[model samples]
Target: MEQVPLRKIIHIDMDAFYASVEQLDNPELKGKPVAVGGNEVRGVISAASYEARKFGVRSAMSGAQAARLCADLIFVKPNFDRYKEVSKQIRKIFHEYTDLVEPLSLDEAYLDVTENKKGNPSATLIAKEIRQKIFETTGLTASAGISVNKFVAKIASDFNKPNGQKTVNPDEVEAFIEVLDVKKFYGIGKVTAEKMYQLGIYTGTDLKSKSIEYLEEHFGNSGKAYYNLSRGISFSQVKPNREMKSIGAERTFFKNLSSEIYMEERLNNIAEEIERRIKKYKIAGKTVTLKIKYSDFTLQTRSKTLPYFISDKGLIFETAKELLYQEKLKDSVRLLGISLNNLNTHQKKFVVYQLKFEF
Candidate 1:
């Protein structure tokens, strides 16, 4: 028996997730400009409602610019607990159709429905059902894109955001590629987009025209990636069941530091990075380990086990600092890493305790 190609990918993204949740809970916020993030002078916007977007407000924009864009813009800090609850709700909805779900962020995920729970094989129908369920359950709208591969599905979802969807059928992949802007392709960041524009590669057609050799000569290995994507030959699959692995971060310095104060400062940064990863996974761990690699290539590790799991940045930093202080390393350090282990799968219970203690 010939195996059927297993490629039914769909990308589902919430529309202004944080801002929409605020509006859903507060009726007065509807139709008004809302920005969800820190409002401090140095803070940047994390999510902007459609009303704010019309006035040039965007995620990562300075608070001052966002405020100037919409004098009526209201700022609301992100509530991680509530957001995590919503993410679980959406994930449960995804599980209704397929177990093959890969979450990219709290607001985005890719699902493979080649063989689905609902018994419907068409990716388009599965996306529709998922979007409808989200609106019915959370009072929020979602935009989805159905395509033959992860790359196309991801790009399709962004084409019509805010309660809309666009599908890219396998047969129409070529036309889709030809019409797409080079900047819109996946993996083409702002820096790469600018570089592509300078090289007269403004569209997918322009990118496709460049031979593999030409791209490799200029952009290295990534050049081959761009060449294939431009021809609508994206082969990336919808990866599933990606577990939350041990969270850690290591950084190398330009200069080896012998001073204790500077080493701790560097450790603080590494600790914060680990905390960010734990927060992203919505999980906490019970062990804190600090890794120090000396300038002479010698490595040292110090670990401490905590009574309770933690996801807070300050706690991780404190534990890592304690480990570093207790270690009797006399050599100068070149690199440092902070890591967490032993996840307490019961995330909500720990989260509540964390709020009471850490907050």
Candidate 2:
């Protein structure tokens, strides 16, 4: 059997994207603890600057709690339009090197530059050049990781953060993964890490000792993934033109309420936001899902699939309202959200190209 050559993958992640953009547009915000999204009264922090992070402020944290963590933290509204404009500029730089680019979000992406347009053989040099071009074009910093596959590349990207890059050579892949902490593995979350710890699997070496049957018995299907990933084996490809599965918006109120009237008003605002997002993407969905969270931390979702696709705010709110009253209130609600899926966007076929380069 002919041996397959190694691939050259790079993962690029912007540093504090939202907060950095805010600082770039307003110099006065530079060097200060800044947070984008929400107010002290309600909502959640979308992103926090490096300065804010030192005070334990983090994304998805409640605004009131973040304020308590950092006394002088400044809050700024998220400007998605501005962030999208910058993202476009950065993506143009990536396309200049390779067409195989997979955007994970507005702030990060994976690029397969094994056979790049530049004819560059060194993935490290390409990563360096790409980061430099991104900073030069958008006046923002980016970190990169270059390796033989996406999983290692994603982990290496965080080794040197805030405008830095790391490379894991093909020969070094196994050893690098062996010493890595299980918690730092890309797909393993806190809960899974705890389970691994209970089984005496604290690092890649420990995890590799377990048999596939043993892992599967404990973690179900994910055990197979952990077994392979621990040995530096990953078959995931970097797919370009990734489809958007869904678009949604939600809000956490400062106070919980049992009044259905107030919930209806909140649902209207969320629907308007969803409509704006769908229109911006030029897509409509046949499914509408309403998410409710109670004060006791219990969560529930109600969904309805329409016969026809719709993007109008009026239709979205009406559909969510119908789902809301479809069942009785279990407890006082603290958060409400609306999401649209089963989009009209065309799904692209995934094709895997054989690797032709080796380090």
Candidate 3:
């Protein structure tokens, strides 16, 4: 097997992205506790400013709860269009350094700068330059992490946030990971962290001590992933605009429905939503899937692969309706969802237009 070269990977995350954007456009909100969401009883916060974070107000928390955390918390509705435009501007900056940029979301992206246009040998210097350029161009701060692989770099990016950067040299990878809490591992979620805690695995060092067989027995396929990640090894590459494998939306209803007529009505709305998303993303799939959650908490899915790709709203609704009624109901249905899959293969197009960096 050929040995892959040690690559320079940098993960760039904008500081409190959506909230920061809100603050940038509204100068009055600067240095004040602000949250972006619906300020209603059941409304959830989408983003919280650094000032709001100090009071333990956070994204995904209920708006009512957030208000309680910070009595004077300012609520601002999110403007996704404005956020998308800012994200585009930030990506243009990454292109100036490397073409291998993979955006994680509107707030963060991974850049492979192993071989860059500037001929700079130091990834640390490149990260510093990127941060400076982002601040100058967007009036927004970005925190960056530089390392030999994406996993470590992504974790490092959050180390010193709100306009800071950290770099883990190749020689320092092991020691850097050794002391990290398992909960801090990017892929370990809350549930997994609790499971690890039960197993007496609190940190990377503890995880590293587990034998592969033991990990596999405990975590199944994820065992190998945890094994490699704990040792600072990542074979994953910075894939650009990875293909859309599936597109779907689901909802859990407040009241479960037993009538087929009501179920079909909900399915129609879900199908329309899926079609809208497919059009927005400029992608379509051949397979149509219908998902159902029963009042008893049991779930089931039915799917059919079409002979042709489709993006039409009418056809999506019709197909979903047919799938919904294909089988008799076992109990009252609580949720209905539709998704498109087996995506159409698209010719990858790279945007050639480039704007020169002023700095």
Candidate 4:
């Protein structure tokens, strides 16, 4: 008998997640540049719809700049609560296949389908199925990349966007990397790639020719990671760590709120989402945190740890609401969030938490 290895990984990234969500919920927003983010004079854009991109709008840019770039840019603040619901649905889909799923953020995740729950051995098929499920459930598209390793899989997923996919077979690994831009290599960000360019390392083959010492001299530990990734060698393993040392959810509103009625409504939703996730895992925590993004995009978080753990929605909202009121910022509220942390040790024992937050 011959021996075979079992290491299959896939990366999933939602295309313009927030903006897509707005389009999904509002028929009129499709095909139009939509920016979902802060509107305050000082706030920055959080998500830009595909339509908005044509005008050079982007997330995390000054709202004013995004507006100036496209006079027609329609700004719809993020509906985090709804997005979380969609996220939960997608996560359920992932769990149906593998428990070893790691969600890096609200919009991205990695799945270790090595020994998937569905008994589906083909990682490519699993990625396809997951992307399909996400589209069907959320009315938004996702891009997926499948490969034997995470780095290749991540790059593969990004190869196509706004609903795209790519896969890299193990045998074609080195060649797949050789043609990639140096910046596409794992751990190679814009700045680092510029430095690599200065070293005349423009492609995987160029980086491969350099001695380990040369790369180390230039990039430190990250250089080592880049070198390994170029060869399709990733030692990273997928583990479930969901209980979370901290649990939090945030949403940017479509319009800034100066009234308590609207703010409370949104805050309650944020609290409820946290509570729902906490209960989904059958865990509780003593600390409650409230996060706020003012009209200017200036963010702040305040938290308090109670004497005992709780999963009560009302209590969590109240604690967070009070915290928000205390801040009493002189600006409109653009975003609100709630979080739980410092769980009782007993909570950790019963729940097999899967960790998905990754870089």
For TM-score, the strongest prediction is 2
**Ranking of models by TM-score:** 2, 3, 1, 4
Per-residue C-alpha lDDT of model 4 across residues 116-215, encoded as one tens digit per residue: 7888767888888989998888788999988876678888888888798988877778899988888987667889889989989899888888777877
All models: lDDT?
0.82, 0.92, 0.87, 0.80
**Which scores greater on lDDT, model 1 or model 4?**
1
Candidate 1 vs candidate 2: the TM-score winner is: 2
Question: Using Cα atoms with residue i matched to residue i, what is each candidate's TM-score against the true structure?
Answer: 0.72, 0.90, 0.82, 0.68
lDDT by residue (175-269, candidate 3, tens digit) is 99999999999999999999999999999999999988999999999998898889898776787776677999876565668898987777778
TM-score of 2: 0.90
Order of candidate numbers by lDDT, starting with the best = 2, 3, 1, 4
Stretches of candidate 4 exceeding 4 Å from the true structure: 1-6, 242-359
Better of 1 and 2 by lDDT: 2
Clashing pairs in 2: none
Of 3 and 4, the candidate ahead on lDDT is 3
Deviating ranges (above 4 Å) for candidate 2:
1-5, 279-287, 295-298, 304-316, 342-356
Give the range where candidate 4 is weakest over 10 consecutive residues by summed lDDT: 350-359
Tens-digit lDDT track for model 2 on 1-359?
22333689999999999999999999999999999997787677999999999999999887888999999999999999999999999999999999999999999999999889999999999999999999899999999999988999999999999999999998899899999999999999999999889889999999998999999999999988898899888878788978888989998888997998999999999998998888889999999999998987688999999999999999999999999999999999989999998899897765445565564
